[model samples]
Target: MSMNDSWYRASVGDVTQRDALQGDITTDVCIVGAGFTGLSAALELAEAGVRVTVLEAEQVGWGCSGRNGGQINPGLGCDHGRVVAELGADDARKVWQLTLDGVELLRSRVKRHNIDCDLKAGILLVANKARHVPELQSWQHELEALGYDQLAFYDRDALQSLLKADYQAGVMDWGGGDLHPLKYALGLASAAEAAGAQILERSAVLGYEEDGRTVTIRTAAGQVHAQHLLLAGNAYLGKLLPWYRKGFMPIGSYVGATRPLGELATQLIPSRAAVCDMNTLIDYYRLSADNRLLFGGRASARDAQPNALRATMRERMALVFPALAEEDFEYLWGGQVAMTMSKAPVFGRLGRRTLFAQGYSGQGVALAGMAGKLMAQTVQGDAAGFDLMARAKHWPVPPGAPLQTAIRALALLWYRLQDSR
Candidate 1:
């Protein structure tokens, strides 16, 4: 099977194709999907001496995990301030700490496993409009109240000095970072395998059969019978498990990596920070370690390729740094992510033995990795934190999903209007 033309595929060379499911293969645990959550869970499980087998429908990292903007940013997709407003300050504090720990956990994994994915430090939360400066300031205030310190303010004047665009301001998070997403995913898979987790590529799970305490994952070429099952197939999970899919509406995001930018890349963001805008449907771009500008945004709920990659993304990237208006695009591809109505991740039980987690929106890089380990903890009877996250109800797409696309379009229009204002 041909892999998607993701930035990771281009940067990391060809993905190894594993034959589809074959005969019966039993294990202590069976995890579907080779993306962040699945592989993260596998890595943790194997470390704990848990027998684990990870099955990917295609090659590992062949999903959004390898094909995103690669911004290992902190926090969920929504504003941490919004979280404070909705869930009260105490709960919001807990969530905020979790996100902080999420980033820390990601860094620890990369270092502990000796994985070299070009983990660069710092991410800039750039404001596209002048009005957004207040929000960034307010966020800084809240973080200060929370005793968080690691971010620097880049005022309009400061932005002009460091950037080539006419932007209002940006919040530079010294703690957050960027990386080669595909390479990171592959490294995670390799680490899990080294730790005793069985990883097989091209194993599309067809169906699962259960009898008493044993659950058998039936793949096209083989079957994995295990006592515990974890469903980490975020958006590629077509119908292997209908209940898990119901919690999220699959949506697509496109990314285009320009030809390496050489010195211009460092000049764009001297700190080489990942840049994301302030909007519900926003644009995010960052410089690859190799200096290619990786830009991502523009949501599509259906199966549609970007209309004009160079023109659209280059325009958006130029919005942040107009110096890249004519940057040459090297590869353009789209990958789908599971999005819940609340935009928070869903992690809970499916039936009695199966554990499920998905819908990280766009901030799954670290969150998903942490989620997998937490899910493993949940399986081991430590469910306090996992329950809190799982209990976060997901407002799924409309029953027929007929209005989802339209709703997202209108929602984008409304946010765009608000952003412009």
Candidate 2:
């Protein structure tokens, strides 16, 4: 992967060109951060007749929400069985249904609002190690038990027809797909604004003070006084919520997009299905609507933006398909996602009248919408759904602070070692 400025800018076509912030505002809800989560919640709330104001530190989709791998995967980073094992089968079913609704909701929004972000269908979960076969089989059986026929197993022979060499097996899901995430975000923001929601760009929240009834959010341009507040900042929220910091440890993940491969790109991944190779620290990639290979992986907690990530990601992609070792790489952009220790996304109330959701790990494209939707539900006096997820306890990194990085570094080393053998 090459580190060029113009590398793989999503031919996302165009967006509504919404205006920036210029004055103070007051609304029923003040959402801090305009990524998928914030825009999503704003859309739902506004559509429900709730006045909402969204404040983005930068332009919409400028954060991880836009620059992610762009694979619209279903479910949490951890599987449904993990959810049941930790929670219960009943609650897990509700969670699974929401995950399915996430992708469906995205599709409906794209079609209903005419968001042309190159929406494509299908996502393949590939396994490189022989050890991954049983996991895929188990996942297939689990999904089947839940009456979900969306998943199909692929043996090495079947996988050969779709994926390039150096892979063992895979699980293909028909419902979930890939798209230009930035465009989807832009479309959602546009839709939210069109529905009478206030969206302000380049307006960072300086501070917030919450009383028992309402919260006051202070920003650079002005402030937002609202009955409730939603913090959708995710990995960007370093110490905004100190109590939940341990619940979500920000992990830096990098992605690389290749120059258009034309017919060859289509042939390499014949189905054009978004692919994620199974590993504790996995590698996920998909074809940009323009046919560029958008590959992503690796984990780092520190270093907001590493100087050079292209070569690092290139090596990872080359390991799976050496044929692309000589291809002209295009992009080396990376983003951060707040990963929970349990690998399940955390959503619930923080302080009274305040709602928060983060830590989708790498599965935010769909889950973030679900999180935002959940926020709407919570505000409406519906606590059943949110309570199930918020109950999952997140173990804090042992001594906290400086030791967290050292702990994650050790954990990454161990996981990579496990992946090697």
Tens-place lDDT digits, model 2, residues 1-421: 1112324344554444555666666789988888899999999999999999998877788778887877887788887878898878888898888888898888998999999788988899888778889988988898889888888888999987877756889888988888888878888998998898988887878889988888988876777888999989987865567653447777778877788888878778888899988888888888876778888887775654544666677788888778788864655676667888778887767788788889888889998988888887788778777787677767754546577787777778898899888
TM-scores, all candidates, are 0.93, 0.94
Model 2 clash pairs are none
lDDT string for model 1 (44-81, tens) is 89999999999988788888888877888777876677
Off by over 4 Å in 2: 1-23, 244-246, 304-307, 397-401
Model 1 earns a TM-score of: 0.93
Question: Lowest summed-lDDT stretch of 10 residues in model 2?
Answer: 1-10
TM-score of 2: 0.94
What's the CA error at residue 213 for candidate 2, in Å? 2.9
